[model samples]
Structure formats: C-alpha cells, structure tokens
Target chain A: MCELMALSANVPTDIRFSFSGLCPRGGVTGPHRDGFGICFYEHGGLREFKDYLPSCQSAIAEFLKSYAIRSKTILSHIRQANVGGVSLENTHPFQRELWGKVWTFAHNGQMPIEQVPQPSYYQPVGTTDSEKIFCWILSELRSAFNADVCISQVSAYLHSLCNRLNALGINNILLSDGDAIFAFCSTKLHWVARKAPFGEAQLRDCDLSIDFASVNSDDHVSVVIATEPLTKNEQWLAMKSGEGRMFVNGESSWHDFGPEIIHKKSEPTKIAS
Target chain B: MCELMALSANVPTDIRFSFSGLCPRGGVTGPHRDGFGICFYEHGGLREFKDYLPSCQSAIAEFLKSYAIRSKTILSHIRQANVGGVSLENTHPFQRELWGKVWTFAHNGQMPIEQVPQPSYYQPVGTTDSEKIFCWILSELRSAFNADVCISQVSAYLHSLCNRLNALGINNILLSDGDAIFAFCSTKLHWVARKAPFGEAQLRDCDLSIDFASVNSDDHVSVVIATEPLTKNEQWLAMKSGEGRMFVNGESSWHDFGPEIIHKKSEPTKIAS
Candidate 1:
C-alpha cells in the first residue's frame, strides 16, 4: 500500500516537518517509494508538486524542507504502487473540475472495478483505478446538486458517498475543493489535534522532534490525519475500520460506514480541539 | 507555468467547490495540462494524489469534487510543463523523508542550476530543476540543524532561506511537513481571508458561486492564497514583488526580501490593498 498525511489548522501552518519524517518510508525506511505528491490550498487556487520517483530521493521533497509553504489544509502521499503502474501518470492526488471549483483526491487502497461507474462531469486522464473511482464520485455529486447548492447539503451527500465507497473495500481517502477536507477510513487511518497546552512531538520515522508551544499562539488549533502515526510522542487516534470523518475549519465530524464488519467507535470522541 | 490553490481556516473545510472551478483550466479552460497534484494534511499524516495527464480529464480529479476529505489546510496544483519533462518523474508536489518527517514541496517558477548544490541528506529523483532546488534546500537545513530544533527556530531559519530563494527569481512556492505551512512570494502571489461575515464568492473561471455563511458556522474563519485571483467577488491581497509570507495556525506573517526595494525605510509607505 502507501502512506498519507494531512493537516487542518485554525491558522495557516506548514507540514514540512511531518512530511520530512514520513517521506523516508517511501523508499529507504519502508517500501512506499514508487511515487509521491503533495497539495496546498491557497485562497482561490491550489499549489501542488509530485514525482513519479521515490519519495526518499525526490529533490522536490528536499526543497519542501526549507520552502515553508503554509496553509490551513494540506494533503500528501507516498505510493508503493499496488494497482497502477509506476509511472507519473498514475501518481496520486489527482485533480478535476466540476461546478467551477478545482477538486483534488488521493487514495490509499484498491477497489474492484464493479464498485465504481463511469463519471459524467469528470474523466480520468490516466488508467489508475484510484482516478476512476474519483471520477465516479464527482459525477454522482454533479447529478445530485445544482451549482448553487450549499456545501452543508453537499457534505451530507458526500457522507453517503463515503459509505458507498467503503463497501468497495479499504477506501481510505482524502479530498478537497480549496475550502474544506473530507477523509474516510476503510482500513488504516489515524489523527490528532494539537492546540493550546501543546507539548513536544517526536517523529516516529526520523530522529527529529518539535516543540509546538514556541511557534503557536494561544488561538492556534490544528488537527492532523494520517495513514500511520508519524510521531512517537503524541497520541494518534486510529480510525476504526469503515469509519468516515469530515474535517472542516479544524473540526472533525464522523459517521459510521458499517459497524457490522468495522470496529466499534471509541469513547470520548472529540470533533475539534 | 503552473497554478496553485490553498485554504487556511479556523475550521476544517473542503476545497471541492473551488477545485471544481480550477481543474478545467488545467487543459480545458487553459493549458496547464502537463500534470496535476494535490495534498491534504489531516490529523496525523497527509493524503496526496497526482496525475501526469491534464487535470481536466483526470478521473481522480473528478472524484475529489465530492470526496469529503476535510481539513483546515489544503494545497492543489495544475502544471504546465516548464523545467520538467511531461512525465511522472517530473510531477510537482514532490515528497521526501528527513529528520524522521515527511516533507513536501511544489514550485511555480524555474530556478538556475547554480541555486542547487550536491545533495547530502536529500537528492533529486527526477531531472527537473524544481526537484533539484527542493533537495538542495533540505540539504541546507539538514546540514545546519539535525532535525531536533524548535519550530520557531526552524521558522526563523526558513525565513532566511526563503529570502535567499526570492533572490533567485520568480520563486513563488508552497511547502509543508504535515505540521505547518510556509509560503514565499517572488512575483505574482495573491491571498484573501474569509470569516464570520463571509459572503458570496463567484468563480473567475466558471459561472459558479457560493455563500460561505450559509454553510459555515459563525466561528469559522478561512484564508486562501493563489498565484492569480480565483474569484470575482472577493478581494485578493497581492504579494509585493520580492516579499515572503508565512502562515501558521490561521494567521500570517510577512517579510520583505532584501530590505524594501520600493522605498528606503523612512516611514515605509503602505501600498494600497
């Protein structure tokens, strides 16, 4: 499979440090080195970079360490190439347009062809099943709502979509439209919130640590979701199988995809810290 | 050339609507179809997807329109071949591992060979100058700090590094490590913030609009930065040439590269917003 990383903050923040730790696993530390990519949402558009090359040796990865691009929501991935070929065209974090805004998507697991249908408003540029699934989701949404519908209504529709995707098997996904982020977990997924009373954080993949207190203001609040735990020191909440969560403005909203096969929900569930 | 999209918010949000508007430009509305990528920083790690084909037709892009991966910080991009070849090896939003964290980066401008030196901790996996520059930056930071530094100190050093990069030329960039976001502008960067009094937003590339207040809570706050204005109804703050800005949590800090060249200190004149 592959690895994933995401950040949702009350303020604009950079994910370079966490990415720095997770990237090694793409090839050196682990085996997810087929390709890697990242995206940052600015006000009106999106900034993204990717490499069909392994994450461990990609120069673009190195540049991010010092570039320091900050945002309220960000997504990143390192692929191991399960279903798609190890070509740039098959890289994750795909983009498409519908109803005017640019939409982005990334996946961590594979699905059977029977799970998805052909898309209407969006189409796949590559042959990856991940891309095909993304297209199917958008087409559903376009047919469901008009261009002027409220996002909340869209969010409810998406919750149902995630449920349908979860039935396809291991549907861990990350998606955005330059405004909010929606995450779903079918297999491996985890998350954490760093806010006031923040403490030190040590990387699980590298020999680095960061003290968030010094750099964060009292009003600053952030939530992170990932495929695996990146830090050894903090508490990373694992998403129960078949669980779907929506993060908006640094807060999380969750829905159960199917409790019959998935694990039970944990107590003391917090939406946004 | 390439286009970037980012969102910084007080809450977790999705960029599907905005991305829906921007993806068409990546070969449909415009010509940035060489490749496309996106990254979303979740609670712990990141989720990224990319395709070497034009985003307009990419299936993955279509899926994102309805995918509910919500986060406060989001980044997305559509590429028009510049320094890299039209292959996956040269995709944007490259990733790597350093100091135990996954680091990601994407660039909008080209860089000279002189800007990058031999790599140490990181190296380029592609032939793109963009990747070379990314690795060089990581090498510099690794050589200077062993990955155990405080976030503030790292931010300070990054500021200096960004200043140096701005001197190179058209260094508009966005970077993250799944923790915070850092942005530097050399030329053609713009941003806007939306909060409690959020209003209607009309897309510049498509005939679509959204009134954020109808979907968001009163406490919600969001900020967006882009290379060009994505909306016709909102006011965008353009970064002065040779300036750098950093966003943490939801707030922003800016610095001028090489001491304000516009007018020597003496009660600096505020440029019209």
Candidate 2:
C-alpha cells in the first residue's frame, strides 16, 4: 500500500503544508519509503517531479518544500513498492496526453498485474501494475469516445471502470486532467474542504502546524483528499468503499455512491469545513 | 527560433559544461529567452525539468546545474517562441512514449503549421508548429510499423519525414529514444565527439573553461550536438543542408548524405576528438 494525496481549488494554491505532513510517512515515520512523485497542473500544462528516492531523503522533495508552486489541481503519491522493482520508471503519478489534455494518474493499492487487461492505445513504460491500470483506463476512454468528447459525458463509464478495479483490491486512486480531479476509494480515503471560517491545524506525523485563517482569503475554496487525514484539528469525511467523486473548481461536480449518482448542479451540498 | 542541444555517450555522462554555455542564451547573452526545458534519459526512464521563466532566471535551472544527474543520452532546448505563446505546454523538448520507450524531440527552426498534416494517432498538447510536426512524425511511424518494430528498420522513413519538413522551412531537429540520437539539419547544426585524449575546451557564451583530460575517464566517449558550435576550441562538424545522421554509443551509427545512405555496419567511422 501507498499514500495518495490531491488538491482541487478555485484558485491556485500550494500543497506545501499537506505535503510536509506526508513526507515523514515515506521513511521516518512509516514503511512507505520506496519512491515518490508529484504533479502540479499549472499554466494549462502539467509540471511533474518524480524520484526513486524516498521523500524523506530526496533532494528534489526538499527543494519542493521550499519552492511554492501554486496550482489549482495537484496529485501526489508516495510508494512502498509491492509489485514493481524500485526504479524511476515505477514511480507514481504516471502522465499521458489524450485529446490535447495532459492526464495524470496515481494509485495507492496493489492489484494483480496478470488480471489487469492489456491497454491498446497507451502503453506502460514501467513494470508496475499501477501504470498498467492507468494505461488500461486511458485505452478504454479513447476507445469509447472521440477526441472532442467532454469529460462530463464519460463520467458514468469512468465510474464503472473504477468499480471494476475496486472489486479486485483496494484501489484508492486520484486522477486529474488539469481541469478537474476524479477521486475513487475502495478501502481507505478521506477528504476535507476548506473555505471560510478556516482556523489552525496541526500536522499528525510531524512537528509542524499552519494557520489557514491567516493564509487563505475569504473567497478561496479548496478541497484536499488523502489516504489518511493529514491534520488533527480538521474534520475529514471518510468516503465509503466503492464511492467515486469528481471535483471541479473546488466543488464536487458529482458523487457516485454505490448505485445512485448525484450531480452537484441538482443537489448542491455546502462544503464541510 | 530556439537553441537545441543533445548528447549521446558510451557511458552515463553529465552535460553540465555544455548546458552552462546554453543557459545564458536564454536571457543574458542572447534574446531567445522565452522558456527552457531539459530531459535526461537515465536508468531507462526520463527525468525532465522545464520552466516558463528564462533559464538565467529559473530556480529549477539553477538547481539542475548543481544536481548533476548523469545519463547516457540527453536533450535540452531553450525557446524564443515564434509561432506559439510562451507557456509550459509550448516549451521545447516535447516528449511522447512510443514502443514502450519515451522519445524526446526538440526543434530549433520554424515550419508553417498550416502546411503540416494533422496527426491521426498522437495529438499535440501544445499549439506550437514544432509539436505538430513531432506528432505527425510519430503518427506516421505508428501507422507504418507495428509497436514491436525495431527503430533501425524505420530510419529511412524517419529521414524521409525530416526531408519533407525541411522542404517547408528551416527544420533543425534533435530526436532520441534514449538509446540513440537522430539529428537532422536543414540550415545550422554542429556536432563534436570527445574520446580518450580529451583536451581543454572553452565555452563561447560563458567565461568558463574545463580541462576534460582531468575529469573524463580514458575510455569515455561522448558526442554533443547543438544548433551551433558550443565550444570555441573544439572542431565541430556541420551537417549539410539536407543531411541526417544517427548516433549510438557516441559513434555515428549511420549518415545519410542527400540521396545516398551509409550504414555504420559497412563503414564505422572512428571517433574524432
């Protein structure tokens, strides 16, 4: 298993605070120390940083901590390497281009590589089952629709694919195409939406804290999803097993909770602080 | 226009010295300072660093200069932005995966985007004419051959595509699949190979000199290709107007001079130091 984290915001926001809490889990505080990767969607393109070194020891990770790159959507993962060998190619957050959009995917669970279907459109450069699964998903998306199709039109198909993968094992996934974030949970996933009335929060794994009220603007709304709650004083909503959600501009566009799917346009829910 | 640089080496080598010369052209010494990108093919995987800021002002470029990641093959580009707007997506050294290998491409000249045929397989993530040409080439490759085809078998087809693009405008190109480099020149491209008896060399753009004899091993061999001669002391070979050459393991695998092709299997040229 690995740790997955993501952010979706109405404005460009940095993930330094959340990333700091997750770094310790890579080696110092937990066993997940194989490699790590992070992708920030900025300026209508993707900026990716990946290393085979553990996050605790990676120089790139240390540089990233001090470098504040603001982005509206971000996806990151720290791996423990269960199925593939430790290599730069096996690092998480694999990226591909489809329909003139850069799509990134990162997985947090181990699936049977042999059981996964081979992809037709995209091919995996790495030997990880995570990469194979990502390619398979992209291949399916390309086969089902044309290049001009909107993502909202294929939400049902994407959710079906997520459910099919969830049936095999824990398939906590975070996927983004620079515009929106698609999160699916199989075993463990939690999220927190921060808007107005932001207060202070303390890190769970490290000796650090951030005062959100001082840092955020009144109209700034953002949602952070992670494998586990990164803060102690925040209320995090745990997603039920087999639940899938799509977030755009810091708001949940739709929620597929088992059988029933609820669109945010029809049933808008207030963001839980 | 842009500054293009590439390296093909028998062993893993760092391109810091050549890159140092190219960095200043982004903003300080020259006017081609829109953005910069570099991709290092290391450990059968690719590590890329790109910034929209000028290379002279980019923090990532500064960090990369000190990081010293070694690779057997590398490609770098600094853009001036002629057709496309200055953005991360428009940055050079565009990458795509084909035959399970990450192929990188960088162009130093402009081509008419309207005249170029649209690609059917790979889509351009950016709005640059350079990217469209790269997509068209890859799409043609995928259409002509199967995924399992060897690169050597498609060298002639690739050369034909290069010639086709060269007819439109200046199309100096540097492309690689991590194992070999394919360099084509329509107007300006130069290369220099370094071998056992390495000597001191001075940079033309920067006030720095390096005694390669002390730093490189006796068996080390590397070929550096750039849009113009990077070193003042080195003897660089300028490719003909429509010449295309492929280098592997620091040696010219084949050289196509106009209508005739010379295979390395028949005439292996010695490394020129």
Candidate 3:
C-alpha cells in the first residue's frame, strides 16, 4: 500500500510542516521509495510536482518544503509500486479535465485491472490499474452529470460508487476538483480538523513542531487527512472500513459508512526506517 | 507579440542556455511580462513549469534556469496577454491529453472568439482565445482520427485548419505531441538546426555565449525554434508568412506555405525594457 496525504483550508494555508513529516517516509523512514507526487490548487489553477525519485532525495521535493506555497486544497502520494512500473507516467495524483474544471485523483491500493470498467470520456495514459480505475471513475461522473450540480446532491451517488470499488480490493483514495475534496477509506485512513483556539501540534515522523495558536486566527479552519495519523498530540478520527467523507472550505460537507463488504486481505510488506 | 522557444534533439539535451536569453525578455529586457511557461518532455512523460507572475521575478523560473534538467523535446512561451487575463489557467503552453499522449500548444497572436469552433472532445478551462483555439484543434484531431496514422497524412488536414484560423487574425503558434514539434508563422518565426562542426553562438537577449564544440560530439543534432532570431552569431532561417514546419528527432519532417490570407494587423505595443 502507498501513503496518501490531503489538506483543505478555509483560508489559503501552506502544508510545508505536514509535508515535512511525510517526506522522510518516502525513503529515509519507510519502504515507499518508488516515487512521489503532490498537487496544489488555488484560484488560478492546479499545479503539480511529481518525480520518479524518492521524495527524500528529490531536489524538487526539497524546494517544495522551503517554497511556502499556499493553497486551498492539496493532494499528495508516495508510491511503493505494486501495480505499475516506477516511471513518470505511473506517478500518482493523476489529473484530467471535466466540466471545465481540472479533476485530480490519487489512490493507495491495487485492484484487478480487468475488473475496472473500460473508459469512454477519459483514458489512462499509464499502464497502472490505479490510473485505469481513476479514469473509469471520472467517466462515470461525466456520464452521470451534464452540468454543474450542487455538491451536496452529489455525495450519495459517489458513496455508492466508492462502495462498489471496495469489493474489488482496498480502495483508500483522495480526490478533488479545485472546489472540494473527497476521501474514501476501505482499510485505513485518519483525519483531523483544526480551527479557532487551536493549540500546538507535534509531528510524529520529524522533530519539528508548530504552535497553531501562534500562527492561526479565530476565523481560520483547516483539515488534514492521511492514511495514518501525522501528528502525535492531535486527536485523529480513524475511519472504519467502507467509510467516505467530503470536505469543502475546510469543513466536512458530507459523510457515509456503507454496509460492510468482505474481501480477503493480502500479506503486508514491511520496510526499514 | 509574445516570445516562443522550442527545442528538438536526437538525444536528451538541456535548453537552459537558450532559455537564459529569453528569461530577460519576460520582464527586464522586454515588455511582454504578462506570464511565462515552459514544458520538458523526457521518457515519454511531460512536466511543465508556468508562472502567472513575471518570469524575471519568479523564483521558480530562476530555479529552472539553474537546474540542469535535460530532455529530448522542450517548448516554452512568454506572454504579453491580449485576449485573456493574466491568470494561471490562461497561461501559455496549454496542455490536453489526446490518444494517451499529452499535446501542448502555445500561441503568440489573437483570433476572434466567435469565429473559433465549438469544441466537442476537449474544452478550455480558461477564458483565453488561444486556449479555445487549442481545444478546437484537439477536438478536430480527435474526431478525424481514431488511431495512430502516418505523420505525413496528418499534416495536410492540420494545415487546412490552421489556415482557417489564420483568416480570422494572427495565429503564430508552436505545438507538440511529445514525438514532434510543429511551428506556424503568421507574422514572424525563425528556426536553427545545429549539428556537427558546431561553433560559437552568442545570445541576442543576454551577454552570455557558448562554444558548442566543447560540449557536443560530431553526431549530435539539435533544432531550436523561436519567434525571432535568438542568437546573433548563428544563421537563423526565417519562416515566410503562413509558413509551417514540423521537427522530429532534431530534423524537419514536413513544411508548407499556403496561399496568402488577409487579416487586419493591429499596431504593436512597445514593452518597457
């Protein structure tokens, strides 16, 4: 399995501190040394930085840690390469355009390539089962909606689709369309929402720490989601299997936990820290 | 008018030398400081760096100039926005996926928005006439061809559509599909192909100079295309009005100059140096 990280904020906020904690896991602290990618979405457009190199060694990844780039929504992934080769085309955080908006998706688990639906509107540029599933998901969304619809009215259908994909295999995912973020958990996922009266939080992977009370005001709210809890002191809400949630403007817009569906678990691989 | 730069090389080559010259024109030496963008194609995947900010002041652009990134094909643009706002979504070197390949297009002139065809398979995410034209071009290509066809058979139809767009207004453009670079000149464009017996060349935009003999062997060949001559010492081939050329593997594959088409030219504005 791969590691996924996502953040949503009411005001434009930087993820450098959180990203700092995750970068070490790319190779120095974890086994996911195959590749890594990240996307930042602001008012102008979405900008992506992906490298086939491990984040620990990539200069671009180092630059990102120092750039202080701020955005409203962000999605990132570090791969261990189960279904696809270690190449740029196979990098996660796959992007496409639908309804005049750029849509981005990143997945953490593998599925049966033959079981995924063939694409019509969107096609995978890489030979990965994850990318094919993303294209298939987008194609289904395009077919279901013609024009812009209220996102609140959009979650039920999405929940059903997420439930369907869960049957094939593990499906931990993070997706966004510039305006909103959608996350689905099949096995493991955790999230934390920080707002007014925020206090200090410490990273679990790195020695660095930040005091939110000193940095944030009463009006700001931010939410961060990851495959595992990223902070040590913060209370992370762990999702049950077959659970999904949507975030807009740093707040949970909708959530659902479908009836449980059974699937056999594959043997887990351990990597050195 | 804006500036365009493209490079095609038989082997992986760095464009930082040529890009250094154009960097000054982005804001310091010339006026077209609306925005700037560049794309590098390496190992069948494309990565782009664009800034809504002026290139002269953008740290990302500076990082790009310092990084010794090498690729087989590269395309870049510096915009003096005319038909679109200075936004990231409206930045040049617009990209779309067609037939599992990323197609990039950058334009230097304007066209009537109403005269542009409505898109079917592709649509513009931004409100730029240039982006609309690009989407229309991709839409047309997706409809006419379903699978891989000979490059020679494809250029004739492309020439016709470009000619049609030229009838409405100026349409100087640089386009690529990873395999090749296509350039069309409605007002001014130039190209230079360098190979064995390489000699000294000096930048027209900067005081820097390079002697190719020290860096390259006898077999290396590279083709550079720009809106105007970029070097004073090198002989540059100027493209005639309505002339178009395609480059693959550092050599010309096809070229055409259609009959003269009339479109009113607007007085050019001089940018601050």
Candidate 4:
C-alpha cells in the first residue's frame, strides 16, 4: 500500500505547505520509501514531477516544495512497492491523455495481482498494479463516452467502477481531469475544506503552522483530500467505507454511497456544499 | 529561434553532461531566457522536466543537470519565445499519448501562426506555432496509419510531412515514440555517434570534459543530436535542408532527403554506421 494526496480549488492555489507535511511520510514518519510523484493541473495542461527515491531524501522533492507551482487541481502519491520494482517507470500518480484533456490517477491500496483488468486502449508502461488499474479505468471510460460528455454523467459511471474495484480490497483513489477531482474511499481517506473566514491550521506530521487567513481571499475556497489528514487542528472528514464523492469548484457536487446512493423520484441526490 | 538537443542510445545513457552544456545557453551564453524542458524515454515511459523559468536561474534545471537520469532517448529545448509567451504551458518538448505509447516532440524556429493546420485529434494545450505544427503532424499521422504500423513506413510518411512544414518556415524538429527518434532539419541540426574507441570530448558551452571511453562499454553505440554540436571535439554530421532521418537502436535506420527519396523504391536507403 501507499499514500495519496489531492487538492481542488476554486482559484489557483499553492500546494507547498500541505505537501511539506506529506513528504516526511515517504521515509521518515512512514516506511513508504519506494517512490513518489506529484501532478499539477493548470489551464488544461498537466505538469508532473516523479522520482524513484524516497521523498524524504529526494532533492527533486525538495526542489518542488520551494518551487510553489500553483494549480487549480493537484494529485500526489508516495509508493511502497508491492507489485513493481523501485524505478522511475513504476512511480505513482500516473497520467494519460483522454477526451482531449489530461487525466491523472493515483492509488493507495493493493488488490490481487491476477485480478487486474486486461487493458485495451491505454496500457500500463510500468509493471504496477496501480498503473494497470488506472489504465483499466480510463479504458472503460474511453469506450463509454466521447470527448464532450457531461462531468456528472461520467461520475455516475465512474462511481460504479470504483465500487466494483473497492469490493476486491482497499481502493482509496484520487482522480482528476482538470475540471474536477473524484475521490473514492475504501479503507482510508480524509478531506478538509477551507473557505471564507479561514484561520490557522497546524501540521500533524511536523511542527509547522499555516495562517490561511493571511494568504487567501474570502472568496477562495479550497478542498484537500488525502489518505491521512495533514493537519491536526482542522476537522477532517473521515470518508465512510464505499463512499465516492465528486468535487468541482472546491465544493462537493455529488456524493454517492456505493449501493446506498438514494435513488430519488426525479433526480439523483446531489447535495451541494 | 530556440535551441534543441536530443540523444538516442543502444543502451541506457546518462544525459546530465549534454544537458548541462545546453542549459547554460538559456541565459548565460545565449539570450533564450524564456523557458526550458527535457524529455527522457525509459522503458516505454516518459519522464519530463520542464520549467517556465530560464534554465540558468531555475533550481529545477540545476538539480536535473546533476541528477544524471539515464535513458535510451531524450529530447530537450530552451525557448527564446518568438511565437508564444513565456509560461509553463508554452514550454517546449510537448508530449501526447497515442496508440498506448507516449510520443514527445520539440521544435525550433518560427513560422506564420495562421498557416498552422487545423488540428483534429490532438490539440495544442498551449498557444504556440511550434505546438500547433506538432499537433498537425501527429493528427496527420493518426489519420494515415493505425497503432502498429512498420517503422519504415511511418518514417516515409513523416518525411513528406516534415518537408511540407519545412517549406513554410524553419521547422527543425525532434520526434519520438519511445522506440525510435526522428530528426528533421530545416535550418540547422547536427548529430554524432559515439561507439567503440571513443575518446575524450569537451563541452562547447561550458568547461566540462567527459571521457566516454572509460565510461561506456565497447558494444554501446550512442547518438546525440542538437541544433549545433554540444561538444567541441565531436565531428558532428551537419544535416542538410529538408533532410529527415529515422534513428533506431542508436543507428540510422532510414535516411531521406525530401524529393530525392524515391517513392517506387522497394527498399529505403538505410545507412548503418
């Protein structure tokens, strides 16, 4: 298993502070020393930085922390190898082009190696179950929809797919396609939304604090999702098992509970927050 | 105008030395202080490092120069930014996924932006004439052939397209599909192969010397291509106008000179060195 982190914001936001808390887990606070990667989405373009070295000791990771690349959406992961060797090719936060837009995926759990789906359109370049599953999910979406499909409709289909995979084992995942971020929780996933009247937040992994009120405007709304919550002061929402949520514009657009997603009379339950 | 550099090796080779020589030119030796990027092909996967910051001032660039990531092929560029603004999206060496394989492209020189063909499948995420031309070329190839076509046949078609674009402006380009690298020279390009009996080579842009004979095996054949030779001592093969060459396994697989390339010939002029 590995760890996942993601960010979705109404405005372009810096991820350095949150990332600083997570980097230590790669080799210091945790034993996930295989590899790590981070993907940033800006204006329909994707920039990624991946390294085979543990983030705790990686200069690439060090450079990235201070570089402060701002983006509306970001996905990051730290891997502890199970199905693949420690190599750049096997690094996490894999991405592929889909629907004329870049789509990125990161996983934090392991399933049966033999149960990995046979890929069709997108193939895994690295020998990782995470990458293979990512290819499988994207291939399924490619076959189902064209380039201009609605996000909610795509999420509807993806909800089913995420549930099917989660049934096999722990399937905590972070997926994004520039427009929105979809997070599904199987075993461990947490989220926190920072909005108007923001206050200071303290890091749980290290001795650090961020005064969000001094940096962000009142209109700025940001949501961060991770395998484990990075901050201790904030009230992080612990996702229930089999829960899949879709976030757009820094707010929850839809929340579904696997089979328990209440099918209302005319429309599906979409609780806006 | 911009600078381009690429490498294709029979075995995985470190690119730090050549990249170090090219990086300083972005600001110190040259006035191309817009942006820089480097692409590496390793085990069917692509690892790219790009920054909108000038390479001379970029910490990311400095780290990459000493990191010494090894790969079989690489493509890099430092932009002077005539066609587009200096932004992350406008950085050179753009990549797209096609046929389950990642394809990367980098271009030098400028052209009339309006003349760039309308894209079909691939679209330019950044507003640049170079990226527009790359999209056009790939879209043309996507319509022309399927996923698993012969390399020679694909090179033949690409030869015509490269020449067509070259007729418009100085369209020097480096293209790769992980397996082979295609280099086309419209204004200027050069290449050199280092194999058995290799000797010492000194950097042209910096005061760095490398003794390839001590580092590489006798059987290793590596080819380096650039806008101009990176090393001072290398006898670089200066490419002629409209000359397109396909390199596979670190050797010239097919060489074409636009109109001089015969259409009816059953065999191509493949020069093995």
DockQ of each model vs. true complex: 0.02, 0.58, 0.53, 0.37
Write down the TM-score of every candidate: 0.50, 0.93, 0.95, 0.86
- lDDT (tens digit, per residue) of candidate 1 on A1-273: 788888888788878878888899989888998889888875334567677778889766776675677788788888988776786556778765445455678888765544566665455645677877888887788788876653434666776776666655556888877567778777789998888897889998889988899788878888888898889988889987656677766777545545524422232122121
- Report lDDT (CA) for all predictions: 0.71, 0.85, 0.84, 0.83
| Candidate 1: residue B174 lDDT (0-100) | 75
Residue A252, candidate 2: Cα error in Å is 1.6
Instruction: List pairs with backbone clashes in candidate 4.
Output: none
Candidate 2 chain A lowest-lDDT run of ten: A264-273
Model 4 C-alpha lDDT per residue in residues B1-273, reported as the tens digit of each score:
899999889989998889988988999998888989998887446778888889989888988877878899899999999887888778989887676667789999777677777878776767899988888888888888987864445887898888777656667899998888999888789999888898999999999999999899999998989998999998899988789999887888899877432221223233221
Cα miss at B152, model 4 (Å)?
A: 6.6
lDDT of 1 at A270: 22
Superposition error at A203 for model 2 (Å)? 1.5
Candidate scoring better on TM-score of 2 and 4:
2
- Chain A TM-score by candidate, in order: 0.91, 0.93, 0.95, 0.93
TM-score of 3: 0.95
Order of the predicted models by TM-score, top scorer first: 3, 2, 4, 1
Give the number of the best model, judged by lDDT: 2
**Which prediction has more favorable DockQ, 2 or 3?**
2
Model 1 C-alpha lDDT per residue in residues B1-273, reported as the tens digit of each score: 788777766667878778887888998788899888887766444556667778898766776775656777777778888675776557777765455345677777765445545555454655677767677777788779855653334766776765665555456677766555667666667888777787899988888899888988988777787878888888889887666666655557444454433322223233321
